[model samples]
Target: MLAHLRSNPSLLKLDLYCKGIQLDDSCLVTDDGGRPILRTRAGLGSGLEAILPGGLWTNVPVTEPFAQHSPYTLHRFTSGTYWIHWQGEPVTEVALSPRPAWYDATLPNGKEMTHIGTLQGTYLGIYQAKVCEYWTAKPEKTNCKFCSVGLNLGVDDADEKSVEEVMTVVRRAREESGITYVDFNTGHYDGDTYLDILEPYILRIKEELGLLVGVQTPPHRDLKRYDGLREMGVNRVSFCFEIFDPKLFREICPGKHEEYGLDYYLEAIRYCAGLASKGPRHEPWVTNGEIIAGLEPPESSIAAIDWITSVGAVPTVCVFRPLVHTDLEDWAPPKTEEMVPVFRRLYEACMERGLPIGCAPNVHVSLVMLPEECAGLSKKRYPWQRLKLEAKKRMFKYAFERRLQTLERRVA
Candidate 1:
């Protein structure tokens, strides 16, 4: 049931992304207790991710999936009553990722804390210095045709956020929403400008809040810079080599291909894991290779899963979302049925390797099911493995509940 919810986000949501928490209309979908849920479009375009109860992560459609019809809709009972129904039956109780208590927090600079970083899934996302050189560069030669990262410039958040503004939100989110990580995304600005600009923010986040940091950027010309990032306590690194097929990768991500090539991304992550393994600090997974599952043939995704896991990196597979107003707006995404087998293969590959699967629930985003959750479908698990998995699941639940409990000041 959880997997279905994660797979079929368009089945329930009326909108593709969350309308900002500042708007009461964002409450079109909310919990039974009458708290606003997050499933409306955000930013300049309609791409967004949402986390469901029990840590299930899903990519929501920006528009209606079925052209003004779907089996699922929110059924309101009494004034404070709500339930998610599919095909006229209440399948299960559902809730949205709530507005974090610090959404309205004000920074010392007078800018609202949320205006600096938007809450995405469980982590806060800061698209600091939103300019991407590729978008401005020769259009035909650069710019990933599928990406809208640069399209968001000046639409909502600032082009550049100061360290202090980001710090205010991080601290408040930790206290209020219990966010454990900050995922910083950037486009190459002035030849390695992305990391150079992001480094200070990373350093402050580590020294001030002791938060885990994840970076998504094109690989630096010098792969050794990854060691520098690890030394500064970056928890994870991801490269969006969106497709496994080389020709398609080069075509879709012309900037990444022409600038650094796929080898740069693969080697950088392999090196990150190796450096962390030999270093004093170690976490479950140090590197992630992000692949859009439906962008290429399912076979390409499965092959990518095999290769990425083989090289000490986990594959963060996203279902392809054809956003409105992007170059690929008219493109259609694969059906949910097509993705089940692809994700199932992904789950098996990770389990076969015994890679540490899920991040701590507090920090893990639900854009897709973590390897640990997908491992549930494995019928051939060893008895001991099942016991260990159960124990870990309990641990995550208990840890997450502890954070939620803090919200109930009445209990304490």
Candidate 2:
């Protein structure tokens, strides 16, 4: 089932809603930020955001318990052994993500530490503010038609997070879970000063903890703000330009489509990639261009990947989940087969340009396909990258020997 999940993430819906055992809430699932949820697992390739458990799975969001059937269920075969059952047939051995020790700790404000910075896969995800400024706009107008960030995180109308509170959780998460990357993300804010609000927090985290940082926010008019991000040792930055098709982009992300436009996104990604350099500390990924894979016509998604990669940026193709309680809640999820080919192109395009495939095993968010995971592109592995690394090692050895000889001759 785990292997199946890597290639076919749609199966995760089954893993999420599967009902085989009723474990204690604290053990596997617990309330973080007022919603019963599971923080991502490092063990699971990338962690996923999912709804509450113990219900029959439905193709669409339905309140009524009409279909009393689930394709998957959890079964503990014996002590220390577990297996997932598909339609009452045992399919494969599986284990639920272990409850992180830090999840039980408390913050300076006495709130559970988990609420401050929850682990998404191995990366810590902190949504600095609870409500998006766009939500403050007319009810119908928002950047993305399919986003439910504030609602699903159960952070609606909450107070903005203080730097101390967030830093405290970062420290605990590092000490307890060995977290390697910290990703700070925000929905639209009124003043467009999301970077400004994040700067101090980012500076402190890098100076204090020395952790790799990643930020995902709306495009800022002033690209110079990214210079501060580069100096702060940010590993990778991403822009959520949800779709590529200009017309449908306007239909889905009204605020972004009208205000920033697709060209702004392209320019922002290019500017950051050009100057935003994280010298030696962070991993080498420069930028990420995120698109909801099935949001537009599949052809546009392919074109988007091509355009993003051509500009020295990697692409993240997030499979569209039919979010509950959103305007598109009744809409169906994209077919898994359709996404397979689209993801293949995503991988191929990135590999074509030799873009870094993100900070590996760690910081893998289950929400999208990581470039290295694209098996279709793996066949044409670049031997040159390895040869380059080996050459650098050999040159370093010769240079060190020559220096040693010079020092000995001078001393003699």
The RMSD of every model to the true structure, in order and in angstroms, is 5.9, 8.3
Local accuracy of candidate 2 as per-residue lDDT tens digits, 53-86: 2211112211212112335444454264545455
Overall lDDT per candidate, in order of appearance: 0.63, 0.61
**What residue pairs are clashing in model 1?**
16-61, 17-39, 17-40, 17-41, 18-40, 18-41, 57-366
TM per candidate comes to 0.81, 0.77
On residues 218-308, what C-alpha lDDT tens digit does candidate 1 reach at each position?
Answer: 7887888877787777877888788889999988888888888888778876776576475434322378888886679988888998988
Please give the range of 10 consecutive residues that has the lowest summed lDDT in model 1: 14-23
State the lDDT at 66 in candidate 2.
16
* lDDT measured at residue 275 in model 1 versus the true structure, 0 to 100: 65
lDDT: which candidate is best? 1
Poorest 10 consecutive residues by lDDT, candidate 2 = 39-48
How many residue pairs collide in each prediction? 7, 1
Q: Alpha-carbon error at 310 in model 1, in Å?
A: 0.4
